[model samples]
Target: MADQHTQPAKLYRMMMPDHTCPYGLKSKDLLERQGYEVEDHPLTTRDETDAFKAKHDVETTPQTFIGGERIGGYDDLRVYFGVDKPKDQQSDTSYQPVIAIFAVALLIALGLSWFAFDSILTVQAFQWFVSISMCFLAVQKLQDIESFSTMFLNYDLLAKRWVPYGKVYPFGEAFAGIAMTAGALLWLAAPVAIVIGGIGAVSVIKAVYIDKRELKCACVGGSSNVPLGFVSLTENLMMLGMGLWMLVRLLG
Candidate 1:
């Protein structure tokens, strides 16, 4: 009689000449990391893959079987091994990225203040923090202008009427942020920041409060899971405040 305890984990995955399945590689890596010996069975042809799927009554490739019991696909295997939570349990909201960016920007601002004036608690530090945060946020939008613009149009009143405003928004933001960081060109930067920030704040309030609509925010990026709520509102308010402060200083 064969020893069932010593039997290796069996994995069937698609590995055709034209294409290879990524999930298959993930499944293999996961099993290896868990100290399991994988007996990989590659389906080299479409017909062979179809036949395997039909025989196993599964719709996808990269199927795993441990102790002679089927373990569906890569995601299924992850759940089986307690590596990930089930899809239904996962939360959609994520604010960690934005928090991390702001935190880093604050530290940078403080560091710069200490280096320049030998103090970290100066008003200049606060201004630097706001400007640096804006720059970071602008960079995130610039990563995928098209995607950011598309998501922005969902609630931006100006973008809705003027289609090109969505695309131009990121560049404008970047220019304002850079000018603020260098403490130069308040003539142009102040107005740009004021207008954009005012518009953004009003749009967010109308969509989320007045209209009672739920949507994703484009503050961080297009693919961000951050909801259109307090954080988004705060971002715009900060920009508006910074712009006003800069304008006052410039005039006085």
Candidate 2:
């Protein structure tokens, strides 16, 4: 049987009218009740609605369809929900993973609650990592370069100049990433201390799976490891947490 908990697959964006809003909200709630995740693109203007119609070739509003066929609208939905498929029909199917994930999260929370001595070392290492990364990222964001032009130009920050070829930005970014990596190693002190370590790990995980590989590999381009898009986001968030930790420690 098809998994009822599978989210409703949305293939197109939609602009909905206020009159249709009630029906749409009801449909979404019912979908959730039946154990499907529903995502909606509520549209406001006629132009926006027209754009969606043009884009996906959808005919009407307040419709329930999957794989481009009209499943049924509110009236059909009313019948389905009325008797054949009751509200609790799919609720019995256990989503066992949720229980497992919750257990793990609870364990982690308890571990974090316990006091530890190395928390100080964690704070120091995390702050050092954040400072260096902030310096590097501030520089990279400042060095805005086009992807195609990067094939021919380069920039050097430590040397304090631009070479005008693709070489400069990439090389400088690479060196700067080493600074971020150094910061991430602070996790040994608190595991949660540097904060950036988790993001870096996830980024590294995602980068390996990408096939087109368009993102700037600030960490290791020539080497086997390639940088992922989220790597930078994770790095920034981690550094922010680390910096906050330092301020709190110093003041407290």
Candidate 3:
């Protein structure tokens, strides 16, 4: 019987002249990190790779083998090592993306404040935080507007009434965010923010609270798993508050 430490893990991956498989590199790195002596096998040509695939009865490169037992691809290796949950068992809900965006936005606002006024806690910084958050959220929606619109139509009253509103929502949020960030064009920004934010808040309240519907939020993007509820409500309320505040400032 071969000693576990003495036996090398086998890694078969694509290392073609023009293209190297990233997952193959990742698999190699993961193996090395786990203290395995890797026996690297590079498939240099398409024909050679195809032959290897045929022999192995596998469709993809970056196949890993530990102790003569095939461990599959990088994702599979992660699961094998308990580094990641199996795909089917992984939770569909995640707030990490939204939390990350807000965290970064807050940091940026504080940094800007210190740069401008030599103070991290200022009214301007608060404004920056909200406006920056709005901008970031808008950018997320704009990434795949069609997908966002489709998701938006699920619960948005205005989107149901007027399909174009779903398409136009991100642009309006972006416009309001930019104008508010600059503290300019309050006349335009305030109304855009107020209307959209007001509608959004009501729609969310009705859908999540009143109707008790379980839906995915399009806040961070169409494909995000962020649940439609408090986080969505907060986003709308922030915009509503920002718009009303700006309107008051403009009137004053």
Best by TM-score: 3
| lDDT values for all models | 0.91, 0.44, 0.94
User: What is the clash tally of candidate 3?
Assistant: 0
Ranked candidates (lDDT, high to low): 3, 1, 2
Which residue runs does candidate 3 get wrong by more than 4 Å?
Answer: 1-7
Candidate 1 least-lDDT 10 residues: 1-10
**Model 3 / residue 126 / CA error / Å:** 1.6
TM-score head-to-head 1 vs 2, winner: 1
Reference-based TM-score of each model: 0.77, 0.26, 0.93
> Model 1: number of clashes?
0
lDDT by residue (1-252, candidate 2, tens digit) is: 165345353322244444345666666667667766555666677787677666656665456654444455554565655634644554433324223433443443344333333343453344444444444443443354444234222211221233353344344333334433344433232333233334443444444444434444443222212233454445535544654454454457
Clashes per candidate (backbone, < 3 Å): 0, 14, 0
Q: Model 1 TM-score?
A: 0.77
TM-score for candidate 2, residues paired by index? 0.26
How well does model 2 score by local distance difference test? 0.44
Tell me the TM-score of model 3: 0.93
Highest lDDT scorer:
3
